[model samples]
Target: MSDAPHSGVRFRGVIDLDEHKVHDRPTIYVYEAPVRAWHWTNALAITVLAVTGYFIGSPPPALAGEASAHFLFGYIRFIHFAAAYILAVGFLVRIYWGFVGNSHSRQIFYLPVWERTWWAGVVHEALWYLFLRKEPKKYVGHNPLAQTAMFFMFTLFTLFMIITGFALYSEGAGIDSWQAKLFGWVFNLFPNSMTVHTLHHYGMWVIIIFAMLHIYAAIREDIMSRQTMISTMISGERQFRDDRED
Candidate 1:
């Protein structure tokens, strides 16, 4: 017997016709345009910040005697600050999109608030990834996992950048700097300002890890499901599956 359906004839084939028809293919949609642009731009800014930040954090011993070479450090700091500003702007744009954008782009959908449905969604998403489940449940906006990770990471980076940034800027102040006073409470909470600074420095590694995993997961989904996971962010169109089977 053939697997393909024939006119009014049920084939006693070993394979299930329903399974073949049901698991036909996967679909996705483009749900975020501004988000896509912001993603790449933020990536660029972070790269600049990481490179300049390293140089600023540790000066080379070779340049110890050359005062003129200090100019390089100055320029690096300037570039870092500039990139920080750009990143900040990107964050603000994302926040706005969360409200005014499509249902898929809405922040509330992704940011769970102890609801049963949300928790269930989280579990479903996890199982989908573990290969225990074949298809991911559809959501108009950010999936629960993506939402949670993005929220946590964005908050961490924003606060870290602001606090460490002000601290570094206050290095020139001799007790008269407003930045120092503003961050004094935070400084006192840590072992020392250097500890806070170091934490902020190391936090980049966390961001790097997140980035790697995120890209890998997206690519994997795109390949397995034929969904344009990455492109949807740029094109704002998603190929949604009309029907899904668990």
Candidate 2:
């Protein structure tokens, strides 16, 4: 029998029709191990960076003991730096994976604005989120609107953060250090370190907002959409509610 018209349910001709049973639909491996690894690692790094970066900007109450005995702010800076390095390395590895991984892997790097159909999909997804559409289209990878946000919002801002982050680091690394030589140009635009520091602080908040939205969207799609979302990242498998043609 043909798959049931409704999603997340399938037909199986059996002796008992009264009992409803949901059959497993078609599934495909989407995310690779490297992609999943980078996702979690990047998430952790962003978390640490955001939290400690905030404290670095506005430190907590001073400790009672001597400055030598209290390394509270120092330790916070250390964690922020460590997390920044992890984020930078993970970003590089993720870029490499995009080149070698499956076609779905590079979905976030750019848009398919040339294609009329892709634009159509983007509009459809936007309306779906706005409750203007009844259903969301199923895709093995990210939908068009999501790709746009991931590319423009997440990826672009991530690159910005790395650049500014390194430039700020070059301050401590000294003028002769490699970081200073490479990223010191960032200082050229804003000679005052405070200006860059303010921008960097705001960048952290932007990323934090993106993270919250990303998580909310993932969970929402996982529940409301036809395909798996959260589990797909963990297991690299995307299971559709129905075996409908895409």
Candidate 3:
């Protein structure tokens, strides 16, 4: 059986389920293949980067054995650097897909900051999250509130971390290296590599917090909102569990 009878119908703002008549929708192909791939790839990359980046920032107690025998910290740094590069490349590919893929792929890159309806969505979604509102707004992709957070917290900070990461790498990569040529300008802005490192570390926390909230919201929506959340990205189809609109 179909997820529900396919329908293009969507509500642009918050709706009270009690007020609207029922309309069933089984599934929609909201996320394209590239978008799905990028989502999971970025998730794994961020997880690895966070754990390894932590060790690189504050290493564990040193081994008692000869320094040459212990390369644990070195391995940690190596993993951090690898994940950083992976994130950076994935960011670029996601940007490219945002242009070539379907409209949903572009939601995170920008926000409808000036739209009055979008602002209303931000407030209503906030209320819904806090349990102050009885019903959450539903969208084909991200609801307005999620769009705002994804653009500012995840997308913008990802770019910030990428630049600062490469800038830090340029330090050891040598001033003549391509990394320096491409990212050395970051030094002109900060004038100190340590400052870049601190900002980069802070950026990591921003992503971490977003990831936590993203997970919480996904699970919450999957249950409370009567819709697919986690599996949408996995299967590339959003299966709505209710006949209610909005």
Candidate 4:
């Protein structure tokens, strides 16, 4: 007997097996240009901050020559400062985009905590990840659990870092500097600049952890979930593996 008949292939929601024709997948443009730009820029800024921040915490051994001969520590601090400014400015721009950009742009900033369905979706997503559910639901944008994580881990923690970081910067900037003027209030909360430094250091680790989780989730979802994840940021298109509504 001939081998069992091969299952027909489904291409772009249109089943076409015999001809081997190419077809467009069902897709939606979710992330706009500005959102994508901010995403990549923010990622770079975070990476720079993490590396420089690590050096800031545990500096390298002293060089053999004079301090002026090698500005390794100075260069590290400069990079850290530059990346921090970029992160803060990008965050401000992201918030502005949330106001003017598409609906999905605001998802991270606004959590529909009061909605029963949203909480249920969060629970279902959790269960799905726990292997208690057979399938995960498809979403046009971030799933409820992801939205929650973005809000708490990225959004809130970013704000916390900005405040603490600038507070530490104000010490070198002098009491008259604008950074001091604007973020001096942070010092009032912690008083000791060392405490602020410690908090900022911990925040860096937190962001690093968040970045790892975010990347892993995206890659995993791209393969396991019914909807696109990573390509959505690069191409601004979210394509469903199947047309069935979740």
Distance from true position, residue 90, model 1, in Å?
A: 2.4
Better of 1 and 3 by lDDT: 3
lDDT ranking, high to low: 2, 4, 3, 1
Q: What lDDT score is found at residue 57 in candidate 1? A: 79
Q: How many residue pairs clash in each candidate?
A: 12, 0, 2, 0
Q: Write the per-residue lDDT of candidate 1 for residues 129-162, one digit (tens) a residue.
A: 7888767766656677666776677556665676
TM-score-better candidate, 3 vs 4: 4
Residue 16 of model 2, lDDT score: 69
Candidate 3 is scored at a TM of: 0.87
Task: Give the clash count for model 3.
Answer: 2
Model 2 Cα shift for residue 246 (angstroms)? 6.3
Give the runs in model 4 whose Cα sits over 4 Å from its true position: 1-24
Q: Write the per-residue lDDT of candidate 3 for residues 1-246, one digit (tens) a residue.
A: 123534555556755644554356669999999999999999999999999888888999878989988889888988888988888999999999999999999999999889998899999989998889887866779989889889999999999999889989989989999999999999999997889999999998999999999998888888887568888989899977755655
TM-score of candidate 4 versus the correct structure, residues matched by position: 0.91
> Per-model C-alpha lDDT, please?
0.68, 0.90, 0.87, 0.89
Candidate 2 local accuracy as lDDT? 0.90
Give the distance in Å from residue 111's predicted Cα in candidate 2 to where it truly belongs: 1.4
Candidate 2 local Cα displacement, residue 180, angstroms: 0.8
- lDDT of residue 232 for candidate 1: 71
Worst 10 residues of 4 by lDDT: 1-10
